[model samples]
Target: MALLPVDDALQLILADARPIADIEHVPLHEAWGRIVAEPLIAMRDQPPFAASAMDGYAVVAADTAEPGATLRVVGESAAGHGFTGAIGRGETVRIFTGAPVPQGADAILIQENARPLETTMIGVVEPVQAGRFVRRAGLDFHRGETVIAKGAMLDAGRLTLAAAMNLPALPMHRRPRVAILATGDELVPPGADPRDDQIIASNSFGVAAIVKEAGGEPIDLGIAADTLAALNRSIDAAQAAGADILVTLGGASVGDHDLVRKVLESRGLELAFWKIAMRPGKPLMSGRIGPMHVLGLPGNPVSSLVCSHVFLTPLIAKLVGRTHHVQAVDAILDVDLAENDLRQDYLRAAMHRRPDGTLVATPATRQDSSMMRVFAEADGLVVRPPFAPEAKAGDAVRAILLRHI
Candidate 1:
């Protein structure tokens, strides 16, 4: 069978994905980083009335027209407390920031511009124009207005705004639950005394991190030995946990011990595609068992991570209604590169910025997929298209950054 193109495989995995319909009401404090399921409408106008913007006297603009005019202090207005009586001509109200402006007052005579007189009055030192220092009602937001629209992520700022909108709780979509299973008898959990032949299972942890960063909840199924019964038990556990996606690490390729695909197929998985035309992650598999999406990732550490970035990230993003895009930036190659082959290449490279702000990428001398140390030390992956010609140093190339430089 022909290997599927990377783009085609990704499209198939995400084509049928729809935003989760399971909605839950979450308290304001816990709503952060959750997707809003319904519009958050303002309960009342911000401030709900004309308010003083500064700690000054609230007065009719006309009353402060004269440079040295004296006005009687009618009442005081502080935050959450308003002067009930109206402000007549030649009258002013002692007010502080966020205080509601007394009725019939159109401006504020700032304290710096006002001189204190007897206990009952203040002398105007400077005049303030009408509407000056007065925050109009509904200036920030009006009652019944949509403060936050549906499908918006409740970030810090958005959550604050929702709280200001008088919403104690927000309707949010349920976080997508992803079940992660590691396969292979040669694997052991981290912090275990593994035999010389067995290696610690590390791919699930990285994949789980990616799942979380994509706004999904990761449910670890631990390491499953390379056997049909073990794989079946894990699959059942994932279903019991109501996982939306099942990610199987290792046992995906066409090796004698590769049984992830076979086991999933027996469970009635509708195979989407297996094997992608890309280096470092060629033996990738994607399918769906009923409502649960199934992804069989390669066993190699680098391959699993690269595939996660390329395929699984987008799938989870789609499920949660988050926009996902691969950020690729142009860079100048600092070293020569060989011509391409049938598969797309992702070369791990170090990155530097020139004094002129130009980015430079230097691919590692060794590009082995299992070299976790080399992959860890590199900054990003330099993308090489299939069958591209050899390029010399100083050539322009595109690299996908793993982190900020």
Candidate 2:
């Protein structure tokens, strides 16, 4: 079958993917990068009580407005300590930041605007407004309010908020375990002394790294020979490992050595989609065997990485309950593109910021998807849509940024 467009293939894969169940609870400290399974409701109003926002003298605004007015500081209120004394008319209390506002004192005059008469008294140097410098209870957050919503990714700030709300732990989804299996008789593991016909199996490492970056745990299943028995054994091992996702590195095309489709089907797997009309990754395939989602990537180095960026990353995000996940972006093209073929081309390019503050992407000297060195040096993929006529300079183009230029 001919390849489908990239967007169509993505729609098909996403339609079949189910969000993994949220079935784990982790302590707040260990919850970083985890997705919240439930909404985090505030146990108490933030601040819990009315507090002073500054170090100043709390007083009755009606009496403190008269310049040089003297008021006795009934007591001192420091953070974590409440002034039990009440401040009636012509009475005041010395307060510090975070201290609860004393009763009957509706306003505060900052120390810079007051003259200290003693440790317990001060002369008002300026007028004070009612309720000034008082942070009302629940101003930051109300009691029983949802501080963080479900499916939110926990970060340092979110964890701090959860702790502030007295949540000792959070319900989070378990990290998906992904198994990466590289297949090919001509491929050897890294550090092996390869024969002239053999090439180092480097795609697995890249795939595993991408999996980890996408919030999934990658288990490298090592390289499998092109033979059916070897590939079947490798698949069995991956299934036995309880992997949530199984990613095969090669043998997804129609060639005689491309045995991934047949092997997966023989094991009763359901094929979702294959052969996206995207350059460098047109042979990609996705399916499911039992409970495990399978992603078959093209053998070429750049093709594998591109497909990972397009499909695997989103799959991992979906499994972890993450939303709004997308790759980086760039500005419009600086030059024209020739007529496109039937496939979408993800051209490797170097992207940089121009002096005018616009993002400019230039395609690399070599556009071959198998060139690992050039792929490594590229900062993004400049997208070229299929059937597009000649594009002139200044035409808008979408590019997925890979890294800093």
Candidate 3:
């Protein structure tokens, strides 16, 4: 088959993919980063009453219209226990912060502006205005109103708002479970002694980090040797674990030792597409095995990691009902770049901001796919289209940011 364009391959992988419909109810304390499955409705108005915002005396605004006006203090209104009697003309009530505003009292005279004449009377030294220092009913929100829409992520501010809405728990989308398997005869787990010809397995950890950051749970299936039997055993374990997505590293190309697709095909894998038209990730493959989605990533450390950021993160986000995608912002090029290839290129680039606040992206001199250090130091990937013209320093370009910066 002809090499699939990057965009086309992505469309095929998610053509039938839908966000998980399962909903799990969790307490507000455990809700951070989870997608909301239901609208957050307010059970009652915040504060539930017009309360005092300061330690002061509640009096009729007209009664305190003149300076040095003496008013009789009827009773005290504290939080949770409000003064029930009405304040007649020339009358006031002792109130504290958060206390309910007493009836017939339209304003508050703070203690700083009042002089206690005796136990039952107080003199107002300053003129007061109506509705001053009184919090209105339902100022924040009303009862039975939807405060948060569905599909919103429960962040710190949103979670606190939900608590104030009288909700002890919230409905959230189920976290996606991703099964990660590394396949190679020359691979071993980290901290294990590797023969001269072998190297420690590290790609799965990077991919797992991406999965977790996208709000998915990652399950390590360990390293599988090149043999089909070994690969099949790991795949079986993934299925048994009820994994939503199966991610296989290495063994994706057409080499004799590359058996990821062969093993997946034996399990009736419906191949979607392979050999994307992109540099450093040409041998990428994607498909579905029964109910589980499968992604075959390239063996090179940088290639696998870049593809995870470009492909896997969005897939995990979608599975958990979050709207996510790769984004590229325009930046100024800091160096000359040669181009003209059939496949698109994503060059590791460092980002810097000018004193005037303009962003500049400079591609590294070395972009070998096996170098993890280059990828680590890079803040973004400068995207160059297939068969694009050469670019010069100071040219305008677009780059996909690695971090929000």
Candidate 4:
């Protein structure tokens, strides 16, 4: 099969993937980090009524004159209780923050700007205008207004807004369940003493972590031997567990023992794309088996992780109906780079903010995709296009940030 470019492959994968239709209604507290399935509309106007914004004296604007003018305080209004008396000319009402302004009063003069006098009267230190410090009804939000839109991911701020809008629960897309299967005859589970030819099966753990970070629930299917029967059984178990996405590590290349693609085809999965023009992940494959989307990742540790970031994250986001997508930023290179190979490269790099506020990226000394230590210490990936030439200091480059460095 011909190798497809990174962009083309991604576009193809996304073209067929659709947002999951299954939704679950959860309480507002459990809705955090979940995607809203429907628009959340305000049931009632915020504030509901005109109220005071500070502890002050509510008075008719016409009654508030220049300094030395005194008005009789008719009544006091606190937060829950409101003054029922109508303010006539030369009359004022003592109102605290959030208290409903008295009838006929359009403005409030802060207590600091008023001098309390005997016999329920106070003198205005400064002339006050009408409608000042008054929070009108629906100032924050009006009834029937969309407080949150569908596909919006819930965060702390959004959750608070939903609660304030009287939303006790929300319908959100169900989180996708992902199954990770690691395959290799020479692979052993972590902490197991293995023969000299066997290496710890670490790809499943890393892939599971990536899936979790991407908001999907990962179900580790444990290590599958290189035998065809064992691999098929693992795939069957994952399907029985109701996994929405299945990820198989290793057995994707053209080597004699490589059997992932063959097994998937035999099990009736339609192949989408098998090869991509990406270093450390050229053998990546994606397809659909029954109702589950299956991804075949390269056996290398770094390759599995890179492939997960490139493909799995977006898949999870799409399935969960999230609107926001991951993006890469352009940065200036701080060191030289040699000529690139035919495949696009994702070199592990460290990112830092320079003194002048420009982003600076430096590639790690070791560019081997099999090394996990380098990937652990790296903050992002420096993207190099296929067939590109060497890069010098201060060269503009694109970087996909993993997290804030």
Q: Which residue pairs clash within candidate 3? A: none
Clashing pairs in 2: none
What is the clash count for each candidate, in the order shown? 0, 0, 0, 0
Candidate 3, lDDT over the whole model: 0.91
Q: What are the per-residue Cα lDDT tens digits for candidate 4 across 61-155?
A: 77776558899998999988989878898999999999998888999999998898897989988877889999998999999999899988888
Per-residue lDDT tens digits for candidate 1, residues 1-405, read: 887877888889999999999999998998888899888899989878998899999999998887689999989999988899898999989999999999989998889988889998999988889999999999989999988888899888998888888989989999999999999999999899999999988888888988888788999999899889999999999999999999988898778888888899999999988888899899888888999999988899999988988888898888878778888999999999999997889999999999999999999999998888878888889999889899999999999998898
- Candidate ranking (TM-score, best to worst): 1, 3, 4, 2
| TM-score of each prediction | 0.94, 0.90, 0.92, 0.92
Worst 10 residues of 1 by lDDT: 316-325
Clashes of 4: 0
Per-residue lDDT for 269-338 in model 2, tens only? 8998887888988888888888899998999999999999988888888888775356667576766678
Query: Over the full model, what C-alpha lDDT does candidate 1 score relative to the true structure?
Result: 0.90
Q: How far off is residue 369 in model 3, in Å?
A: 1.0
What lDDT score goes with residue 315 in model 3?
84
lDDT for model 4 comes to 0.89
